[model samples]
Target: MPEGLPLSHAQEALWFLHQLAPDSSAHNTGVAVVIRSAIDLPALHRATDELARRHDLLRSTFAEADGRPVRLVGPDGLAGLEVLDRPGVSDAALRAAVEAALAEPFPLRERGAFRTVLVRRGPQDAVLLIASHHIASDATSHLVLLRDLLRSYEPAAAGGDPTLPPLPGTFDDHVGAERGFLASPRGAETELHWRRVCAGAAPAELPADRPRSAGTPFVGDVCRVEVDPEAAARLRAVAAESGVTEFAYLLGVFQGLLYRSTRQADFLIGCPTTTRLSSKTREVVGNFTNTLVLRANLARGSTFRAAAVSAAEQLRAGVAGIRYPFPLLASRVRLSGGAPLCRLTFNMLNATGSDPLLGLLLDTEHEDRVVPNAGLLLSSLPLPQLGGELDLMVNVRRSADALAVEFRYNANVFERETMRRLAGHFARAIAVAVAGPDSRIATARLWDTAEPARS
Candidate 1:
């Protein structure tokens, strides 16, 4: 939380990415959390206006007026917010209002890069809706924005002064760095490297479960899976016995799940990195995140535990070298310039604060705002907590009337009940390997389950 450092987060990283690839469509994603309180609407608007004024980045938008990307800094007058007052509205009605606002096509060719739709859910509840274009926002940013807005709201409450920091750098600085990098010698080498990596390698493509549409769709769903204390203890024991990172064991379990769900051995999955490599810009807020891909090579005879270990090794190395920007990688590996390398990103979010007011002054705070089309498999449950029960959320896309599922399982394949039963199966398989390194993955469960022992 110290402002003395120079490390950057995903927000700053994304800004740099946009500067490198202004036409990249994978940049949009944000979210809105409905907070219900008997707060004054006029006061809230004033606060929002004030908030926008305080942060230059929030006041700016991505633009291409002359066919060159530029920051469209917002006018102080237009920073005002509006709360749609709809009293006596049901949940369905509230949803309808949101849907209508979402349905409004984003005017990206215009000046600002984002939009806000404030709707009243009830006398006490209101929706602080944010609709930001992909190039300028993402989920992490959404959270930051919310935290700040709420903090700023308190001061805007009593007409008191809000404390805000002087931004050491702007989004433009990120773009400038990316631009310079892209034109440098390292940039050329990186592009060539990427071309070879992706060359002749088959793309991980998901078959459409339904009809394909050219229409821009934003369908999404969330599934929550928690690992309780008892199970987590077993997991820890197994991980220790196997001599691998807990994350590696978890990835192995996920690969098994993916194999069951998708029936594919190889997959391209992305996880997030904090991207704060140095101390100079540590507290500097912006998109400082990048994606590290895990390509699992599961085969018919591969044991679940082996897969986990393999995954762990890959992650350890990948996480260490995450300083490499993925946009640059795409250029390096010489993949199609327009298409992103990976689609399904397994984002293990690590941005939650230990202290709610970690680096905030009483006068100002930042909330988590989001970008368009963030990622799947994004969950943020801090490590080493609770009855071993940990929370995991599977986030997928859907505008409305869609569904998502979490394949739940205990650490025993036979005792598990899933169409694929991969999570349960892999857990048991890996646990055995942990308990006995040389044990076969197909061997019986190392631990008992709700079901009786298998013959």
Candidate 2:
């Protein structure tokens, strides 16, 4: 009706930022799907060529005109997909190849939007490595692309021609629509409100344990900590009794953990918002996320339940303020000038869909993720499909042997391990909050890795 294809709201949002800043949130995470299969050099090439022709965005890149950035689409100049040839190579070999392929620096200019590097591990074992710069993509995009490509690779799944449903509007149309909306009176008010909320808020200044280097320093320090089954049960009851989403309850627990660990009066923590409102945006994959700083000021003696409720209310309010960007606050808010809004970020994603590599069913016996960067990364990875079951991973600096909250204040401004200890502390907090008043959650502690004792 409108044009080639109408981008869902999330796609439009990403396109909006891609047009403005080529290095926006769109370029945050890169997805790598390790596939082991005999390389069909000719077949794969044909498929990739078709894919590049079918999706213009995948072949497009950013260009500078009069010092302004613009999207440039044309015939892609990508290399032919190769086989890594690692037959006897250990799991570590496959992993290192994937990481090396991803670590290759991408220039912001030219048609460097996305590229696929095929490592031929062996005749029957090869990894399909795809590394796309985030400026033009998101995690959902990766999942969708991977899933679609796998479907196409199926022997029975139709061959030759690929037919995509007609799109209602082009990405540019959505961009125009958003531009018109941002020019409204309500839009201006949204700016003012955020200004008030963030006025004088200072960033959590965290110094690297080691000397810093130039260029974008990716602090991918991580620590994996899990709560035993019994502690998880206790947390569930407390979350239910508190009447808050696990996110909110966890936020409260996390804040208390950070405060107890760092003793910082005020600080900001970052978290990713799905930002997908309607079903279209939700299902249509792309980066439709906004990062917000969850500020906490723990009052001494405040119960964990009270702290959790406070955290819950703030998240509710913050998510509603989607139109406000962190950068906009720079123009509106006063005080704490030039300080980072947040140094730590949290992402709680629940993506359950057709496995990206369903067709080529390669035996994925050993799987590991490489996220070597993030000042502080917290991920609630895909777990068993059950209501009470959840796995929380806290990855911090290995040498610092601590958590992000710990680095809030200490030898520098925070100590790392203390923050990690707080991650455990949150579980303890939830156990306490949800434990009935007559019962003591203080006694209900979370045991990591192994099983905890019963009362």
Candidate 3:
């Protein structure tokens, strides 16, 4: 065993959070890629092994040493894939298998934080399960892993030498760089900005079906709704006219709903920002996700266009000032009895580079996630079982054709019907905003159970 290296500040915070509920799988995250083409099982196994070796974080385990978190880089052999042959398994069975894999928590001190499972349902159809501890991976890391796996598998499947590129740096090097920056003058300046931002932040809780638990649980449920291509196109037009990205428009709609839901004009919302500040860290796979808290103090009778423009400005600032670690910032803010600083999370994840990969034929590509209805099949996954740190997360993804939103909420605190109603309200809010960006958002008639539908 190699001597453990101290984890990045972000990783250390995640480690401490995971330790809070050692048995829960709330922090587990992964992606399941379904391939309907011929998969050379042996080649895939070798490819995964090589990929893990290339990225030290894939084989990273964690434990505490002298009161600080340390990452244990396990051997390459620890990153091998587990193949499960389920010839002619039913769709329900396949779903159950995927769920089981997702629910499996990592033994942080024992094994590496990554696992790969190949479930073969037939000769040509199989689902690849790639599970990783959130502390070890993030949204971009998932794409990086998939890109490398495919690149590695293509040649290995053909019995040829793989042409995988060398990673520019390792996760350890990232930790060292982060430490150096955090100790410098710029770090202190960033910390001060964070303190100022967080000092005004409070948990923006929504009305729930039931009271919150003393300690949050990871029990999760998802409700998905899609903005149809027509609606999406209209939104695009509105965004173009407003001179803001579609995300900013969607965010403005969400902020409008938040104002209505909470009835608080001044509240904080959390947005996830990537910490890959430079191209140097682009190819390196590790946890570089940062959570930024933005103030949503919408003015009464403000137009959605104005809100979106303001949101766009905040987003730019947030991205530019996201070098500070979120955990450390959260720690700096003093909450009442250790309460969370923010509750509602609104994330508009951009799905790029995966579409071309999907268009290739099964035999030539050797992988197929071809879906007749892209919105339903590519809907957002459930929220990260972050031990119910937040009551609700609005995860939106704008695919090639449609804009899909999944309201992932705590089952313990929300009923399915409540979420369904909320989803409807969100759709209405966006539809109204798309129709008239200049209209006052507060004046828009959001749906209520008692209010009859507009004729």
lDDT tens digits, residue span 367-452, model 2: 44321111111111211111000012232211111112111222222245644554555545545555532332223344453542
Error of 2 at 120 (Å): 2.4
TM-score of each: 0.66, 0.71, 0.90
Q: What is each predicted model's overall lDDT from 0 to 1? A: 0.49, 0.49, 0.75
Indicate which candidate wins on TM-score.
3
Give the per-residue lDDT of model 1 (tens digit) for 232-319. 4465567666678655766666555555445566665666565545553343335656667667777766675777788887687566
Better of 1 and 3 by lDDT: 3
Candidate 2 scores a C-alpha RMSD against the true structure in Å of 9.3
Q: Highest lDDT among the candidates is held by which one?
A: 3
* Candidate 3 per-residue lDDT over residues 38-129, each given as its tens digit: 67777888789888888888877787778788988777887789888888889779767876887787887888688888777887667777
Candidate 3 structure lDDT: 0.75
